[model samples]
Target: MSIPLDIAALGERAAAMIEELGAISQSPDTLTRFFLTPEHRRAADLVGRWMREAGLDVTEDALGTVRGHWHPAGEEAPRLLIGSHIDTVAEAGKYDGCMGVILAILALEAVTRVGLSRPYGIDVLAFGDEEGTRFPTTLSASAAVAGIFSPANLTMRDADGISYRDALIAYGKNPDDIPAAAYDPDKVIAYVEAHIEQGPVLEAENEPLGVVTAIAGASRLSVTVTGEAGHAGTVPMRMRHDALLGAAEMALAVERIAKADRHGMVATVGRMHIDPGSVNVIPSRVVFTVDLRSGSDTSRRDALTRFEREAHRIAAQRQLSVVISAFHEVATVPCYPDLQLRLRRSITDVDRRAVAMPSGAGHDGQAMSKLCPIGMLFVRCRGGISHNPAEFAAPLDMGLAAAALVRFIERFNLPHLENNTTGAET
Candidate 1:
């Protein structure tokens, strides 16, 4: 028998928890929790307290990831991992990564209340380093859990010149213990997460929730345009070989190529630096960064090629030398097919059609995918805004998400829904 789901109560509890966690931020006015900071330590302690209250065995790992384990099937059974990060970007919204951890706790709390029994166990993880805002590394916490963490990352430094290794030591952790944080891949079932859509797609489609099709691939490039610096007032427009002008045109080329791609593609020239910064100077050199993302790797590669050609052509026409170098690149990670079908069914059980979409934002699932099959559920937020103070999701929608996750947990045997008999027996 399915236990009755009180979405209103669930949502209210989730909202209360979110408010509590949102208060533990470094900034007095905005949320700015970073990895291994004092704010993060407080936040992790709070999460650990909640996990223990929810009837789970709470523990903190070497990287400070808080783990809440519920294992009715014994310690040797395979495990289902559900999690999201707790770190935040500067001036971040409360619901981006925090909601996922909150929803997992609520859903599992419900399961525990009913004493649901299964062949496997569940681990609710609250990772500490997804934002990558502190150190020069993102997903290091998840990478450690997935057994893909590189020791070289320990040498990476933060803005305050603190090495990641030193930060870990200061945080009361031993770097050598990180290896024990990794779970045996053979004993793991899969990883799942529930996060806000972080975009306008679900709101535009009038859906409360979405099933992520894939986490989009991303490529970052640094482009440099070199030309002669001359007196801005004396150089005639026709004779001037301005590097800024070439860069401006190249940025437009990036937009045009992305716009024309069949796959959903977005590109941005988010940062730029001009040498000999002066209002009267002609700007001899311009350096800018391009962030390109697409659901299709083939299409993303094609767009990059086209952008390179356009950059060189524009530079040649303007008599400027250009150089393009890739700094970061990650391929797309698709949701497991079986998990997708199961998650879609669970949404249908909530009486809402799940909108299938691609996540333009990066997630820890990209790292966890190396360990096991991965899936994600996206809840709709107001105005499709994220990484800002204005970010919000309706309490009822979050409640519905909790209820849907319960339904998913109830039917996690990876069999046809009709054939699955186990449920949240009340």
Candidate 2:
């Protein structure tokens, strides 16, 4: 007997979980619950209790990924994986990453109640440290599972110079056991993540949900403009070697390039510093960081090249020395098309005209994609604000997202191309 999906029950459970998590003040903004922190560990313990209450076998991996498994009562078991991160950015909202984990719990509850065993098993993961609040490395736990994380990452330090390995030890976890977190690709049939739409696309279109097609690739550049500093009162504007002015020109050039490639292209100068910043003094040096992103690798590369070229031209005209340094680069990740089709079909079953969209923000699914087929569902966020205390989603919209996810899980089929499950008792 297949269990009936209860949309209301699922929504209520998700809302209650969100409320419980929101009340815990982790940071000044009350959202900076980084991995290995006491508050983050507490959150993990709470989720573990919830998983046990749902009658799933629960365990935390060496890297702190919490796994909750619901095994079918019959033979021919299939393995369907659903999960997302539970950590938050500094001053982040409750729904950004936690919604998916909560929804997964509800999905399992509905699945078990219907006494409907899938042809495979289902597992829910509350991934740790996807936001990388304490350290600069994002998706640390997920990358570890995908075999992309290296031993070098363990030595990475936070702003206070606290090594990740040290933090793990302090948290009562073994950094040397990080290898145990890796997963065999053969065991995972499919990966699914549900997240809030942190952009205005869905809300602008007046849509409740978005089926993701691709995740945008990002490139970061650190630029420095150098010029001879002079006394502001003594030097005339034309005779002055103003590094700040040259940097301002380059910044506008980046904006121009982004505007030209408005087809899903974006550039931002979020960080800047001026040396000798003081009243009545000309800045001798200016440094800034540019973040460029696009859904296509070619487009992203082209934009970066154009921005660099323009920066050089502007520097020459302004008599400034410009240097560009590569800070970070993440290639665009295309979601599995067949898995996307399954998600679309599920969404269409609920609302016929669901729109396909691209995700601009990085996600745990991006890292998981390297190991297995990955898919994502996005719920509309109020005003598309995230990474802040005011980030929000309507209850009706969340309810709809939960419904869509349940339908998708029910209809998805797992491949049997691997022999690992051949000898397993089912």
Candidate 3:
């Protein structure tokens, strides 16, 4: 017998929990909970308590990942994994990572309340770090669970000079036991994540929920534009080889190349630094950062090539020297087609206006994919605003999303669905 689902009440409760989780932050004014900090510990405790209340066994791993298990009795059965990161970026909105974690727990609770017996158990995971705000590396906790966290990251130190290994020890975690946190691929059937869209797509379509087709691959680069500094008043407009002006031109070119492709390719120059802090001095150098991402790697790389070409062309036109370097990047990740079908059906069950789109932002799903096939459901968030205090998700939208998750889980174990998995071919 399926217990009646009160989506409105569930949404209200989820909204309240999201607000409460945001409150367990390092700062009172903003949500900035990082990996293994005091605030993180408190957040873990609260989440653990919620898991216990939901009738699941809970434990915190060495790397600070909190897991709640709804272990099935009798024979060993495949497990369905649902999760998202608990850590937040600086001044983040309450809904980004934290909302997924809360929603996963609620989904499990709803399943249990319905008393549906299945061959697969359910586990809710809350990863320790996803933002890379405290350290230079991202997805440490999820990578550890995926059995791919590099040991070299342990020696990498933070701004306060605390190595990851040392930080683990300080947090009562044994670095040597990091490998034990990994989940066996054979034991897991699929991984599902319910997250806020963090973009304007769903809102633009006037929908409450959507299914993710893929998570975009990203390329990160640093560029330096160099020119001669001169007296601002004495230098003629044409005589000035201002690096700042060149950088501005290059930035605009980036937007042009990305939007010109017009297939969800995105390029952003988020950071820029100017040399010589004098109001009357012409800038000699400008350092800028580029973050380019797209569902299609070919489009992304082509845009990057054009970006660098345009940057150099602009620099030469202004008689400035330009240097471009690629630093970090990840390959484009595809959503499991089988799981996406289920997610799509689940959304249709809840709301008929469902759209399929690729995520512009990288997520924990990228790492978890190494362990098992992953799928995602994105609830609409207001203004596509995320990583900021202004981020907001309506309670009604969350209600529909919660119902969709419940629908997905209820139909996940159908034998026909298992007999024809697209994951093996992929």
Candidate 4:
């Protein structure tokens, strides 16, 4: 991927930034940066320094999202938002959420160096908490910027019983000041995120980049199965009401139904626990977590209803009681047609093999949809692996992504930029 002589330096810079941020993890053994922790704050500070070096003024919000502002002609043109989260899932890879921010910086840096005159400005945002590993709420940082931050979210707690409000204060910011983070949407065009594919589709198709059609919505469930505990020797197999058995039946049913759906539905039972662990004792209780996602909200909800109904039936047949609770549900965000067309053109200019695909993963764009149009570009990742130590994206792919982004920026346009400022930003 031989790029233009002047902007080619950005590709190497993107790879180096990924490595630098990967080393700033909480654990010395694996990369594990979380929200509002010391590591996250440190990452914000580093991002500010890099933003300054790129000739952009910097700011940090109450949620610790780092903002780098760039003006092509030192005028207040419509702002073009480009960035991803710096926070990571447990044992996360280098490029899951962080790559978008770094690659944005690199692309904007090239624009800054070349003094390209444009009608829109560029803002590189390093969002603070997209992974939701510690806070249990994803896209909270970008939601704040979009002016959609819910007051109820502050009441949420972490695994260690820390409230998000308290965590905000401990992170050295005023929880009451989140409203100040809101930006004027009329001053912007749209939001764009460059990220790793985080799936095998691009590799399977032998393409380096894909323009996202839409991001899937998610519904999270916690299920419990309860039954009587008894001595294994005293209770015959036919007489025992085993909760674990019922749970196993329900889990298999979830897989079977999800595989039957045609709209790319994916259901996962990622976490589970079985009680009464003694080898001689019949299992008394079981708890498991379900994560269901798809491109259509109706389809996702229908799948959920079917799974829950079948789980209850299985529990009744096994003489066990079942309970299910939904803790979170985020709506799907479709890519606005204007931005999608522009992104498709950008991808075509960079590589003729680019295609359009749906993202099964949720992103900050889901939260930012309330503010403006959103588009995304995905670089191929090794084996479609993410949120792990083994996840990786090639430097050549980063270059390819940078080229696409540069093309997108050069063709940047919105109704507001051509005439009056558009409303409904924050």
Point to the candidate with the largest lDDT.
Answer: 1
Estimate, for each residue in 1-426, the C-alpha lDDT of model 2 and write its tens digit: 223656666677788888897665575447667888888788899888888887788988777888898877332354677989888887779998898898888777766766664667888999888998888788989888776777787889998899999988888888778877877776678788889989999999998888887788889999999998889899999888899999999999888887887447788999999988977889999999999877778788889888888889988988899999998988887766777788888777666556678788999887777777778889889998999888988767777777787788777665543222111110
Whole-model lDDT, model 1? 0.91
Clashes of 2: 5
- TM-score list, all predictions: 0.93, 0.90, 0.91, 0.86
Off by over 4 Å in 4: 1-9, 73-75, 134-136, 152-172, 226-240, 316-321, 415-426
Model 4, position 274: C-alpha lDDT score: 85
Q: What do the candidate models score in CA lDDT, each in turn?
A: 0.91, 0.81, 0.85, 0.84
TM-score of 3: 0.91
Candidates 2 and 4: which is better by lDDT? 4
C-alpha lDDT (0 to 100) for residue 177 of candidate 2:
80
Error of 4 at 72 (Å): 3.2
Inter-residue clash pairs, candidate 3: none
Top TM-score hit: 1
- Winner on lDDT between 1 and 3 is 1
- Better model by lDDT: candidate 1 vs candidate 4: 1
**Model 4 TM-score, 2 decimals:** 0.86
> Where is the poorest 10-residue window by lDDT in model 1?
417-426
Full ranking by lDDT:
1, 3, 4, 2
On lDDT, who's better, 1 or 2? 1
Expressed as tens digits, the lDDT of each residue in 1-426 for candidate 1 is 886799999999999999999999988899999999999999999999999898999989999999999998998988899999999999999998999999999999999999999889999999999999999889999999998899999999999899999999999999999999998988888899999999998999999999988888889999999999999899899999999999999999999999998767899999999988899999899999999998888888889999999999999999999999999998888777788888899988985699988899999898888788888999999999999999999999999899989999999873321111111010
